[model samples]
Target: MLNYSFPLTAAIVATFFAAGLVKGVTGMGLPTVAMGVLGSLLSPLAAAALLLVPSFVTNVWQLLAGPQFGMLIRRLWPMMLTIVLGTVFGSMLLTGGRTELTTVALGVALVIYATYTLLAKPLGVSPRWEPWLSPVIGLVTGLVTGATGVFVIPAVPYIQSLDLDQDDLVQALGLSFTVSTIALAIGLVWHGAAPVGNLLTSTLAVISALLGMAAGQVMRTWISPQLFRRLFLIFLLLLGLEMALHGLLRT
Candidate 1:
C-alpha cells in the first residue's frame, strides 16, 4: 500500500477535483492543474509521470463517450497527427542528458502558455491556416511535454477558435490530451520514468478527477459557452504567470 503525507494527500485530492471540473465543463485541463501543483512538490520528472495515467484515463472518457466523436475525428485528424509526431520528436531529445534543463523549460513554457491563453484574441478567421498553424502548436506542446510533462494550453486557442459546440470542443480537447498522454507515456518509458511506483497517487487522481467531472456536469447547464471561454482563458493566463515566476525564481 502506498501512503502519502496527509497534506500531500489532501492536495492531490483537491487538485484532481479541480482538474475534473475543468475537464467536465470545458472538456480538458486535468493535467494542467496537476502538473502546476505537483511540479512544485515533486521532481518535474516524477510529477510528469504521475500526471500521465490520470490524463490518459480522463481523455478516454471525453473522447470516446462524448457526442461529437465522428465529427471531431474528421476535423481534427491533422492536428492530432502533428501532436503525435511532435511529442515523439520532443521525447527523443530527452534520451541523453537534458533532464534538468527540460524541467526548467517546462516551468517557463507553462507560464508563457498560460499568459497567452489569457490575452489572446478570438482565433484567426481561417481554418485554411490551421494546417500550417497546427504543427507549430503540436511541436510546442510536444516539446513542453518532453521537458516538463505539460501541454494543452498552447493548443487551446486553436481548438477554441473552431467555435466548436461544447460537446465537439470537449471531444477535440480530450483527443488532444489523450494522444499526448499516450505519447508522453511512451517517452517516459524510453527515458526510464515509467513503471513509476506511483500508481496509488495516479489512482487517487483519477477518482478525484471523475468526481470533479460529475460536479462540473451539474454546473455545465448554468455556464454559457461564452462565459466558459472567457473563464478558461483567464484561468490559463493566471496559471501561466504563476508558473513563469515560480520557475524563474526557483532556479
Candidate 2:
C-alpha cells in the first residue's frame, strides 16, 4: 500500500481540484493539468494511476450531456479503435521503467499542445480527408497518453478541425477523452501500475474534482472565458517548460 503524508495528500487533492476547475470552465484540460502538476512530484506511471477514475467519471458526464451519441460512434469508430491499439502498444514504455523518456515525451506533448492553443488559427478539415487524417491523429494521441497520462494534444485539435458545431464539438471531445481514459486505465492495470488498493485514493481524487467543478461552474459566469483560456494556456506553457528541462537534465 502507498503511504501518504498529509502534505503530499493535500498537494494531490489541491492539484486535482484546480485541474477540475479548469475543466469545468473550458470543457477540457483535467488530465492535462493534473498530469502536468503531478508529474513534478510523482512518476508518470503513478500519476497515470491516480488519474484513471476521475478522468473516466468526469468525461462520462460530459459525454452524456450531448446528443447524437450513435452518430458520433459510427463516425469516429475507426479513430477510436486506432487509439486503443496504439495505447496498448505504446504502454510498454511506461511498464518498462523508461521514466526519463516518458517524462520527456510528456513535456514535448504539453509544449506542442500549448503552442497550438496559443498560436494556431481555427482549422477545418475537408470531409474527404477526415477518414485518413483521423486515424493518424488518434494513434499519435494514444501513444502520448500511454507514455504521459495526458491525452489532449493532436486528438483534440483534430476533432476541432472537423468543423463540428458548438454542441457536436463538445460531445466529440468528451467521447475521445472517455476512450482515452479507459484505454490508459487498462494499460496501467496490465502493466501492474494500478493496484486495487489505489482505488481509495482515486475515489478521493474524484470527489475533489467534482467539488472543484461545481465551484468553477458557479464562477464561470463571473470570469471572462477568453481571459481564462489565455491564462490557462500560459500555465501549460510554463509547466511544459519545467517538465522538459527536468526530463532533459535527468536524462
Clashes of each: 1, 0
Clash-forming residue pairs, model 1: 111-240
- Encode model 1's per-residue lDDT on 112-224: one tens digit a residue: 76567656667753877876777777777776676667766567767878777877877788888888888888787876766546765676678888899899888889987
Query: What's the lDDT for candidate 2?
Result: 0.86
User: Candidate 2 lDDT, tens digit per residue, 1-251?
Assistant: 14677898999999889989998888889999988988878887778888888989999999999997889999999899888877877788876787887787778778889999899997888999988988988898888888788888789889988878888989999999999999988888788878765666877799989987887888789998779988998888888888888999999
Model 2 off-target regions past 4 Å?
A: none
* Candidate closest to the true structure, highest lDDT: 2
lDDT of 2 at 232: 94
RMSD to native for every prediction?
Answer: 3.1, 1.3
Q: Give the TM-score of candidate 2.
A: 0.97
The runs of at least 3 residues in candidate 1 whose Cα sits more than 4 Å from the true structure, single-residue gaps closed, are: 1-3, 92-103, 221-242
